[model samples]
Target chain A: MMKKSDLYIFAILIIVCVLKLVQIGYSRINFSTDILLNSFKKNYGEHIALKKDIIEAKKLLIENEITNFNLSEELMSNGYFKQRIVEFSYPIRLNETSKAVISLRNKSNTCKLKSKLNDLKLYEC
Target chain B: MNVKSTHHQDSKLLIICLLISSAIFLNYFFWAINALSFLKYVNFSILIFLISYFLVSREFKKYNFIKLFFLSLLILCLGSALTDWDARSVWLFHAKRIYIDNDLYGGFDNYMPELMNAYPLIAPSLSATLAKLIGHWNEIFPKSTNILLVLPAVLIQCFFLKDSKFKLMWLMFILLFSGRILINGRTDGLVAIYFVSCCLVIFKLFIGKNLNFLSIKNKKINRSIILVLGILFGIILTLLKNEGFVIMFIIFISTIFFKLLTKRNFSFEDLFFWIFIFLPIIIWKFMATTGGVYPRIIGFGIEAVYSESLTQRIIIRLTDLDNYKLILDYLILNEKFIISLIIFGFAFLKNFKKNEMIFKFVIFNSIIYYFLLYFIYLSTPHDISWHLNSSAHRVLISIVLLLTYFSILSFQGKKN
Candidate 1:
C-alpha cells in the first residue's frame, strides 16, 4: 500500500526520533548534576561548606561535649550531612523549634555541634 | 486514480504529517525538559500548533511532501543548536537574571546598560516567565526558548506560498542555509516573522479577489486588516530591538517604492496605511525623548554639557570589525550546511523575472532591505560583526518568504 521510497523516509524519520530521544535523555542526565550544583550555588552564593565546619560538625556528633544538644531538622535535611551520618549514639528529640542535638558516631572522631534546629534554617548553619 | 490508490496516498500523507509534527514536538519537548519550564513550552506549543495547522490546512495543495520534509529537517537542526550557540550568550545570560534578581527594568549588573537597553522586551519577558514557572533560571531554559521563536517565522512562510516544485526547492534551500541566523534567537527572527505576516496580510487585501469586504462589489476588508496589522507589527518591531524600528521604516519605504515601480494605483488607503504603520514609532520616540530615560547629547564648539568620558571608547572597542569577523567565522564554520544553502539561493534570482509582480516586489524589497542594512553597518560606528551577526541571517527570513512565494507562483505557472 505504501511506496518503497515512502517507507524508507518513514524509517529514517523513526531513526531520527529515536536518536533525538536518546540524545535528550543523555543530555538531561549529564546536566542534572550541574543543575544540582547551580541550585546550591544560587541559594548559597559561594558559601561552600568549609572543611573545618564539616570536620567540626562530625567531631561534635562524636563527643558528648554537645549535651542537651540540638540539631535543627535543617541540619539533617542538608544533602551533604544526610549522606555522611553513620549511626546515632543518643536518641535526639526534635524540639518545638525543630532543633535537636544528637550524639552521632562513626569509627573516627567527635566534637560539639552547633546547628539551627529548623530544616529551613539548616542552610544558615 | 483508483479508490485504493487514493486511500494509500491519504495514508502516506498522514504518515508524513505525523512525522513532521513529531520532529517539531521532539525538539520542543527537549527544550521544555531542559529548561524545566513545561508551562511556557505548552504555551508556545499551542501557538505553534495553531499557526502550523492554519497554514498547513490552508496551503496543503501547495507543498511537495518530500521537499518540505527535508526543509523541516534542516530547520530542526538549526533550532536545536540554539541551546548551545556562543553568540547567544548575552541573551541566555540575561534570562537567568530575570529570576535570580527579580527585576526586569534595570540592566543586570554584569552587562552594560546601553547593551541591555537595546534588547526588545518580548523574548526576555517570555524567558523570565519560563524561569519563574520552572523555579530554576539556568542558561538552557532561555536558550531553548529562543530556539522556539523560529516556529512562527517558519509557519508564516509556509502559509503565504502556494504548492509547487520551485516552492519546495526554495523552501529547502532557505531553511537549510539560514541555520546560523535563525538559531541565535535575536530580534531578527521576530522581525522576519512580522515582516512576512505584514506582506501576507497586504497580499490578501489588495491582490486576493475572492474575499468580499462589506459586501461591496469591488471593495475588500483585507486592506483594513492589513493596515491595522502593519501598525501593530511596526510597534512590535520597534519595541523588540532598536534596529527593529529602522527595519520597519525600510520595509515601509520599500513597499511604497515597489508600488510605484510596478505602476500600481496608489489609493488613499495606501496613505492611511503608511501613517498607521508610523504610529508606533512616533509614540515610542516621543516617550524616549521626553521621558528623560536617556542622557541628552549636548555640545558646542567652545564647551560641552555632558562630560566626554572614556566609557564611550570601551563601547566602541567591543563593537569593532575584528570582533564581528570572529563571530562571522564562528557561525560560518559551525553552521557550514546552512551557509551552503544560502549560497544556492543566489542562483534562483536569475529565474526571478518570470514570476508574478508581487513575488518580484517582495524579492526586490527584501534585497534592498538587507543591502541597506549592510551599507549602514559599514558606515556606522558600531562593531560590524556584532551588527551583522545580530541582524544578517534575519534578513534571510524575508528572502526565504519571497523565494517560497516565487517558487509557488512558478510551479503553478508550469502546471498551467
Candidate 2:
C-alpha cells in the first residue's frame, strides 16, 4: 500500500540513522580507548585526555579523605575548570580555609601529597 | 498514519498526543512537589506511556518507523559523554545540587556568575529525577532526560502532516536542524521543537479547520481539553527557559494579530487562561529577586533596554558592521537557515495564495523573534561577541523550525 517514492524516502532516512549509529559507535570507542589509556598512564603521570576534569575530579573524590578543600588561586580563577570540577566533585565543598588544597604540582601546598592527576594535585596541608 | 484514517481518528490522535504531552510534563511536576515517591514517579510515567501507546496502537503500528528512529536517536544520545558547557555547568549542575540536597533552593547562593544565575529547572529536575532512579549521576544518564523530553513534541506532529512523504520529510528535517542539540543535552532543542508543537496547538484551536465536534457534549469536552493542553504547554514553556516566556508571548501576540486581521471573535476566557498560566513564572521571578538570587539575566533581557549606559552600548553595537556580520554569520550564513529559506521560498512560489494566512502568521512570529534576538545581542551584558558566538545559532533554531514547518504545511495545500 506504500508508494515507490515513499519507500525510497524511508530508505534514505534509515540510511541516515544508520550513519548516526555508526558515528555513535566510533565516538564511544574513542571515549573508551581514552579512558583505558588514562588508567594505563595514570601511574606514570601521563595525560588525562578528553574531559580530563571529569576524570581528575572523580579520582580526587574517590581517593581523598577530606570533607572540604580549596583550589589554588590559579585554578579558582579559571571559570570552566572551577565550575566543572566543583560540579563533578559533590559533597566535597570548596572552602577557602580548608586544609586540603587542589593545586598545580609545581605550586604544591606544604602538606602530604594525597593524589595527583596529570598536573592537578591534591595536597592536605 | 494511514491516509485511510478518518477525521474522527485524527481528532482522537491529537487528544492522545495532548495527554502524552501532559504526561511528559508530570515527570518534572511530580518530582518538584515530592508528592510521588521516585519509584512511584517512574512507574506512573511508564504506565501512562503504555496506556497511550495502546490507545493509539493502530497508528503506532503504521508509525513504527518513528519508534525505531527515536530508538536509534536515544542509543546515539546515550552513548555520548556530556562535554557541552551548558549541559555540565548549568543544567546538570543544578540536577546534581537537587540530587545531593533533595531540595531545590539550598544551592541558590551566588557562586560562579555563570553557574548561580537561576535558569529554569524543568530539564534539570527531570534529569535529577532520572539520576535518582539510577541512584547516582553519570555523564550519560542525566542527559538522556533531554532526549526523552523531545518525544511528545515530535509525536504530536504525526497527526499534522497529511501524508507519509511530508511526515518523512519532517523526520529528516529533525536531523538537519536539531540533531546536534538533541544529543548535546540542552533546552534549546526542547524549546525549539516544543515551541513549534505549541504553535500547532494554537493553529488548531484558532486558525485551522474546525475539529470533529460531533455531539454538543463531545464538542465541549474536546474544546476544553484542547484549551487545557494549551495552558499546560504555556506553563511548561515559560518554565523551560527565560527565552521560553518570550516564545509563549509571541504565540499570544501572533494569535491575536491573526484574530484581528481575520475579524474572528476573540474569547476573554483565553485571555484569562494566559494570565493564569503565567502565574508560575511571575512567582519564580519574585522568588529569584527576594531570595538573594543576584544579578539575574533581567539585566540583559529587559533592564538593558532602558538603562542609560546600556542603551548607549546598544546604539554603539548597532552601528558596528562586524556586530551585524557576527549575527548574520549565525542566523543567515548557517546551512540550516539557508535551507529553510529555500524551502519556504519554493513553497511560496508554488502556492503562495493558498498558504497566505498561515504564512503571514508564521512570518509575523518569526520577525518578532528575530528582532528580539538582534536587540538582545546588542544589549547583552556579557561580551557581545562571546554571547553571540555561544547562543546565536541555538536561538535561530526556532525560526528555522517555524519556516520549514509552515513550508511542509504549505506543500500539503489548504486541505489539512
Candidate 3:
C-alpha cells in the first residue's frame, strides 16, 4: 500500500529508532543493573551508607531530647555536609542559636561534651 | 464506522488517570478539612479496588509493558536512598513533615526558611498518604509515591501506539528519554509525560479529526474523552511542578494563539479548557499565599528592588552572552535536544500539511516556554550560571518529551 519513496522514509525511521535504542538501551541496562546490584548488596544506596553515621547520630539526638544544634567547624566548612546534617536532623534547628552542638571532628571550644560516637561528638554549645 | 473499536481503550486509560489524579487531590482536600483520619481508609479502598479490577480484567494482558516497567521502577525505588538533593530536601522532606506531624507548616516554624514549601502538595501529600498506609515512614517505601504519580502518565502513552513496531519504539523511547528519572522519585518525568499528553489532547480536540490516524466514528464521545483528559492534564500538570505551571499556562495561551494564527473562530470551549485547567492551581497558589508558606526569598520576582547594585547585576546578567551560551548548551546544544529536534523536524517535513497545526502549536508553545525560561533566568535572584547548570537539564525534559512523542505520532511515513 506504500509507495517506494514513502517506504524509504519508513525504513529511515526504523533505522534511527534502532540506533537510538542501542545507544541508550545499553546505557540504561548498565545503570539499572549497577543500581540494582548495589542495592541488593547494601540494602541502600552508597550515599545513605555514607550518611549512616549521621542517621545514627540523629537517633541519638532524638533520644537525648535535643531540640536545637550547631555543627563543628570542620563540618560547617563544607556547605553540603552542613545541609545534610541540618536536613537529616531537621526539627532540631542548626544555628549558633542552639545550645547543642554536633562535632564530627572533636573541635573543642567553650561547649561541654554530652555524648560521643566514634569522633562524632555532641556538646552543649 | 467502527464506533467501539479503539476509543473505548483510550477512554478507559484517561478515566483511570483522571480518577487517580483526583484521588491525590482528594487526599489533600480531606487533610485540608481535618477529615484525613477517615479519608486515608477510603483512599486505600479505591486503590485496592483498582488493583483488583485491573488484575481480574482481560485488558491487563495488553498493558504488560507498563506493568513490567512499573514493577522494575518499584524495586529500584525501594532499594534506593533518598539521594537527589531536591528529592530529599524539598519533596520527600515535605512528605516527612506531613507524615510525622500531619502539618505542612511545621517546618516553617523551624530553620527551613530555605525550603520552597509553597510548591504544590500533590507529591508530598501522596507520599504522606503512602506513609500513613505503612503506619510509619521508612526512608525506603515513601518515596515510591514518585513513581505512583508517574505511572498514570506513562501508562496513558500506551493507548497511542499504532502497532507492535510503534509499541517497541515507544518502550525504547521512554527508557532512552526518561532514563533515571523514571525511577528517581522526582516529578520531572511526570511533568514531561503529562505535558506531552496535554498537547495530544489539545490536538485531538482541535485538528485531529482531519488526520486519518485519530479518526473516531463517535465524535461526541471522543470529544468528551479528550476534554476530560485536557482538564485533568491541565490540573495535574499545573500542580506537578512550577515548570508544569508555566507550561500549562503556555498550553492555554498557545491554543488561543494558534487559533488566531489559523484565523479560526475561537469558541467558548477554548476559554472553558483554560479556566477548568487553571482553577486548581489558582486555589493552590491562594492557599500558599494565605498560609504564608509561599517562597518569600524570591520575593516579588526581583529580590532587592531598592539596591542599585542588584538592579545593575540583573541588567548585566540579562545582557551577558556567556549566560545565554550556558543556557544554549544545556537547553538545545545537547544530544537529546538535537536528536529529538531532528526526528520531529523530519516528520514535520515529510507530513507537513497533515501535521501543520499541531507542529505550529508546539513551535509557538516552545518559543514562549523558553522565552519565559530566559526571562526567569535573567531575572533570577540566584547566580545565573549556577541556576542554569543545576536545573537546565532536568527542566528540558518536558519539551524534549513533547517533541519525541509528536515525532512518533506523526511519523506515518506513507504518502497520503
Which one wins on DockQ? Answer: 2
Ranking by DockQ: 2, 3, 1
Model 1 off-target regions past 4 Å?
A: A1-125, B1-90, B93-104, B107-111, B164-171, B193-197, B203-235, B262-278, B289-356, B382-409, B414-416
For model 1, the docking class works out as incorrect
Colliding residue pairs in candidate 3: none
Writing each residue's lDDT as its tens digit, candidate 2 over A51-110 gives 666457657756877777788888899887787677777667777889888887678477
Per-residue lDDT of B176 in model 2: 67
**lDDT per residue, candidate 1, B302-382, as tens digits?**
122223333553355446767556544533333432443354254345444444455555666666765655445444344
Deviation from native of the Cα of residue B288 in model 3, angstroms: 2.1
Candidate 2 scores an iRMS of 7.1
User: lDDT by residue for model 3 over B1-416, one digit each (tens)?
Assistant: 14454555556655676676666666666655557566776885685466445545665555665665566566656655566777777787778777777864454443465667677767777787777776765555667777766666665566665554565566566666775675566788788888888877776676454434444565565566667767876788888778888888888777777667667777787778788888878887887777666654355333453344545766887677787688787776878778788888897887778667667777777778777776776666677777778877777777778888877777655322
- What is the iRMS for every candidate structure? 13.5, 7.1, 5.9
**TM-score of model 1's chain A:** 0.28
- Top lDDT hit: 2
Q: Which 10-residue span in candidate 1 chain A carries the lowest summed lDDT? A: A84-93
Question: Cα deviation of B113 in candidate 2 (Å)?
Answer: 3.9
The top-ranked prediction according to TM-score is 2
Q: Estimate each model's TM-score.
A: 0.51, 0.86, 0.84
